[model samples]
Target: MLVLPALFDEANKLRRLTVEVMQRLDAAGIDSALPDLPGCNESRQPLDAQSLDHWRACAMAAAAHFSATHVLTLRGGVLAAPPEMPGWNYAPVAGRQVLRSMLRARTIAAREAGREETIEALQQLGRREGVELAGWPLGAKLFAQLEDAAPQPDSAQVEIDQGTIGGGGLWLRAEPDEAPEQADTLAAAVAMGISTV
Candidate 1:
């Protein structure tokens, strides 16, 4: 299985949950790989130079490199999941929704600091040059791509509902957290899904 994590701050919040799910998958005798996106984690690539197309290419490369037969995309990660692969998208989200949340956060921060920032203005700036949201330096191309990016419709990909996990998503939390039961349930769900495939 190739696991693609949620983007931005949600990625930070879901790291532990992702790991927990991977660990459970390992215990279930399923192998998994979580490759770092080009501009994320330990990668030396500059975030400002990356676009959605680049990320999608990198994801396809990772899938091929890992010889993965299945993929699991979390939240905004769904936007980059390889369309040809059989997989599950856990609580899929559109790229614009992800960016809007970050943009709103930035606006709030600006207001708190006695500066005014509107979403429209920020989006205009983002579309022109780029904008740093929640510390991620997004390029104009990437920002523009995200503005209209949605998950590709693929019959091979199954959507995993949050309700199936029996709780609010980990991404909804303000900080990183662990939910052992959620991990257990999610892993079991994936295991079952793979078994039937």
Candidate 2:
């Protein structure tokens, strides 16, 4: 299994949960690997030079390199999942939805600073040069790509709802957190799913 984490700040918030899930999977004797996407984690690539297409390609390469037979995507990570791979998407989110949340945060911060900013204006700027949202610098190409990005439908993939995991999404929290129950439920679900496959 290849684990793809949530994007940007959500990734930070859900890191612990992802790790917990991986640990559980390992305990279940299910081998899994998490690859650092280009421009993310310890990768040396600059975020400003990465686009969604590039990330998708990198994900595919990672899956191949890991010899993964399955994938698990979380939140916005679903946008980059290899189309042909059998997998589970945990709380899938659209790219536009992710950008909107970030843009809203930027606008709120601008207001807090006694400066006016609008989502339209920020988007315009993002589509021109680039824009930084929640500390992530997004290139114009990447920003534009995100405007229409969504998970591609694949018959081989199964959608996993948050309710099925028995907890609120860690990504929705203001800070990083972990839920053992959620991790246990998710890992067990994946283990069972893989067994049937």
Stretches of model 1 off by over 4 angstroms after superposition = none
By summed lDDT, which 10 consecutive residues of candidate 1 come out lowest? 152-161
Model 1 over residues 1-197: C-alpha lDDT tens digits? 99999998999999999999999999999999998888887789998999999999999999999999999999998888888899899999998999999999999999999999999999999999999998999999999999999987754789888998998899999878989999999999999999998
What is candidate 1's local distance difference test score?
0.92
Query: What's the TM for model 2?
Result: 0.97
Error of 2 at 175 (Å): 1.5
Cα lDDT, model 1, residue 119: 96
Candidate 2 structure quality by residue, lDDT tens digits, 92-178: 999999999999999999999999999999999999999999899999999999999988775378989998987688989987888
Candidate 2 residue pairs that clash: none
Per-candidate Cα lDDT values, in order, are: 0.92, 0.92
- What's the CA error at residue 39 for candidate 1, in Å? 0.5
Per candidate, the number of residue pairs that clash is 0, 0
